[model samples]
Target: MPLWLPVGMVAGVAGWFWLPGEQAWEGLLLSMAALALAGFAFGRGGRAGRSVAIFALSVAIGCGLIWWKAERAGAPVLARDGIANLTARIERVEPLPARQAVRVTLLPLSCSDEGRSAGVCDAALAPQHSRLRRSAVGVIRINIPDENAVPGLAPGAVIALRARLVPPPSAAVPGAYDYSAVAWFSGIPATGKALDPVKLITPAPTGGPAEWLADARIGLTAHIMTELPPGQAGVAAALVTGDMGGVTQDDNDAFRRSGLAHLLSVSGLHLTAAVGATMFLALRLLALWPRLALRAPLLLIAAGCGAVMGIAYTLLTGAEVPTVRSLIAALVVLAGVALGREAMTLRLVAAGALVCVLFWPESVAGPSFQLSFAAILSIVALHELQWTRRTFEKREEPWLRRLLRELAALLLTGLVVEAALAPIAIFHFHRAGLYGAAANIVAIPLTTFVIMPAEALALIADCVGLGAPFWWVTGRALALLLWIAHSVGSLPGAVTFVPTMSRAAFALIAVGGLWLALWRTRARLLGLLPIAAGAAMTLATHPADIFITGDGRHLAVRGLDGRVALLRERTGDYMRDTLSEISGREGDDAIALDDLPGAVCGPDSCTATLIRDNRVWHLLATRSAYRIDRAAMEPACAAADIVASDRRLPDWCRPRWLKADPNLLAKTGGLAIRLVDPGVTSVAELQAAHPWAMVATDHDDRPLPQNDPNFARRAWAARDPWRDDRPADAGGMQR
Candidate 1:
């Protein structure tokens, strides 16, 4: 019934995949046709029927659009297993400061056979020359260990390298981030590490507008880094070029904890600052000449200039989702100005959201999109309410009073935004910045009033070779800002870890928040029901007792005393820290085998036991713990109630014993096991119960079997041929 129906449609289409199964295009089409027919039939009725018709039509259109987009962005043809000589043109490059690596996304130009000698980049032997010729335009991500690899690498540069290209990995554990899905939508077919050094065959030439813009950004970032201190330079570069590679991990963590992480991203705030500053300067200069100001519609002209500046900034920053959303909103306002109409904030926001969803549908699932839109909607709703109330009480206020009112409004806006985004932040990131409101109160004004304007001036000055002084001043300001972040972040209780919430609970909370924000009546109080229910559901959920990595190399189980016992000595710090936080473990100190109760360690294996509900659950980390001999492994497996290892166990290991070896791990992705009296239930098993589990497969979307009969036999024989002494009829047991 409203123009925002398209936005709802977009949401429906995006969320369709959340239902647990592969959606059939035929069924979707039939349902849509039925809905359209029903809508048409209902349109003959009164206003109420028309409203129902509109809702049905919206759902139909949304489902159709989602299905169409999925069909268009189909899975790419992946490389075969093993190393291949790849000749590709670099499409994008990002530096990983933490990994000391350069991640390059490339478009494959050619591929050599797996066994071909590494350094071959002949155009004649390209994809066209071989059967590996691929017609689909897909991107491949390659991570080169050398940091220097990306120094001169720009988009459009042709290069060659040998690498073992694998499909993007699925979640390491259930409920974790699904990077494979991200890759699917992003059109990245494969990801791998460079086995040989990346050889640049041809340097990128300044050919097109996009290339020129990228080169300019790269050059400007380098100049800024050269002109400022490392930390200050990093912030400046991010503000200017959206290149955050130089930002150190320590500073990143500090900013995030201090609730200033939004400042690092080039979003609505940055765009508004640049465009508003440009418009202000343009109008000021135009007013100096009465003839020109009078002849031209000054506001319109200024708005046009602002629009142009916003577009330029968007292009310069790669037109990311947040930037695009902001740009669309600004354009809507500018359009209203051009048409001599007052821009309604709600309508403009809705229009911008519709445009973003139409173009970048996947963005609906992203935190940036959700958080950005939610905060803006909340602020707009609050502002509208305040304006309405103020309209009734008309009293002229002094300048000092007006200034104080504005400051209070600013503080209120920050508080509203933080409150609105809290649930989303917790759901996605599992952490809430405790002092986000306080941090925003201090940081927003400094960024909006001081830093951004200075940065804009510096950019203009840089063009005329007079940027050094301005950059120096900007750097000093940034340093002070960083100091604030550090100080605030170091304060006690800066951030609190929130447990993960179920998708259903999060959806309920989101729906409730939207209802409260959008409706302007006492009926809005009804939103409290769903919100309260979501909170209750989250509190009722329990943490996993045992978790295992996708590779089955590491396992962490909660002991009876509520302490987490890490089975392996060497586990990734990231995984360990994440699990520790989930288990409510304090500090980052590595928990040793000796420190864990009921943990018995042998030369190369360890067994940990957990007693729960009058039942004992034994976990065995076999040769994978340290590659113990079969003699050592047999005792650990034979005695254990549940076993996890990289290698498969002997046939004598029967069905009664729960086995989590490499084969099972490969199929499950990662596992979170809950020990019960009768048996154990895993995250994988619960996920598999849903029909969508069959559709959501490995990186290539190939359905992996839960149990492979030959898996263990092949795995055991592969390790040591002479050690395959099991009976011929012995078969593998499913978990």
Candidate 2:
């Protein structure tokens, strides 16, 4: 019963996001009213009915909470790709490897053709006469490729720059990550890369508490980097300040592969270590004065100190979803200690989750929340087992035996957490670390006890100008941790990749996990049934044989050698990585289409033969810079089963299966085709056989209905709000 409230809340929030498009407000309100009435009617029933009534009401509240949040967060999204000169104030700045990541809020500005002819805005721009007609407002995440390009830039500084900006795009493929939706909720409308030099018009002011905290974090990170070597400095900064921009890509990859990447992020582990140390110091100091200790509530006083430390640490670390969740849970435990009550329970977790949902409802759909909660729930459940409790009970025993018992318990916890989080990691990132348990056995203790403590001491001692010794210790500990990550990551089978699975399957697994972790009796064992079923469904998932980008300019096909071949050797990193992830393959070593055994290519066209389900299928695509003569390419196009091209094709050039040319792809952002033995014989059959494969899109990639009543209110859902005419180059939706 204690679990039902959070469960209902999660279900309602998740349901809102999982639905295909926006729901009618009228319909939602009607449903909520009906549920509320049902709850009132059931109030007279027994306790069981009352429990159901409470759950129903909670679900209704959850829906309303998320819906309201979505409505309030709506802002204007950039309609298309263009060169926009804008004046903006920097809201936040993060240092990355050789780059400075800045999130800026755009001010009122105008775009003009004269700005382009001055040799400033040229790459991927539309007609020279066209300009940004929409009022571009909201936060835009821009990356200055050179870290030192904009000197002395920090949060609250106003600067002017002409940057190449584009709207937040939709999923590259069906069921892929949707950045536009995330931007919609997070208030980031566009992302850009700098083209010209940035001009700083104003310096950062001595602002509010939030800006001061940001400035302090930046200064601390700079000091840490200056004192330590590059390899260790980035990790040290991240452990202390949660700014991971300086960590090299190779090091990040090593950590992820080794399953030790969590060390680099601030989460429950960091909070617990910080709180534990604070409480320990407080208790020891109190003990030093026996008279005061006897007269005071030492435990309560220490709890207060721990709570304050935890809260401070959370704020310093960016207050990300995982950190905030952990803070809430830690605060609950501290409150319980002050009240002399048991605090570590599923009920406690439920309370934290409920509060998080009420505040940051969008986090429910993200991997951070899911993985964090999953890992903790699994550990708590493992400890709740009777067998586990009896095996680790306190008793008179040899020191060596107790040491072995503790080691076993640590290993067991690692395995349980790994098993619980593997599916989620793969679902979000396409790969999960295989040896993370072994990696964590060493890396976790090193980070929590050795590295983080030394780093904290170094930061504190630096205030008095005596931090060199502590800084050296922290650097050396981090060096050892990095070495372990690289060594483990290089081992064979360190990570595993899986094809993306359905949301339904993930939900089933999640429900089963909760059932097993929340229940205290024999009923928990039955959770294994759904878990196994979900795993089976996951295994049954199959990657598509062919993939096409939203613009139809990029294509990836599974070749005869079981490796994926790209239509062109040169393409954007985003497109290549997206194709690789969805197909369960690595993108770095993509083979050229012409080099494949059963593929042939010309300057203007290419054809590849694929054998699937005992049938040979031919794919034809255009690579021409100009529209070729339709008559000359008719035979080849007619022979292939699937045809793709960015240019519009003649009506007579229809393929037997799918036509992913400009006209169709404009409506469907991207296409991922899974060939079957008895596939649809004609393109007309696609609507019935493979509608789910289509990535719906408008100008902004929000797959909303054209006639949806609320479309006007949602910028991303509306057709380009600035310009009415389409571009001549078949750029899907142009403003």
Question: Highest TM-score: which candidate?
Answer: 2
- Residues 617-688 of candidate 2: C-alpha lDDT, one tens digit per residue: 667888777766655566656666678898878878855556678777766666667664222111111221
TM-score of each: 0.85, 0.86
lDDT (CA) per prediction: 0.69, 0.73
What TM-score, to 2 decimals, does candidate 1 have?
A: 0.85
CA error at residue 82 for candidate 1, angstroms? 3.2
RMSD of each: 7.1, 8.5
| For model 2, the run of ten residues with the poorest summed lDDT | 726-735
Instruction: Please give the range of 10 consecutive residues that has the lowest summed lDDT in model 1.
Output: 726-735
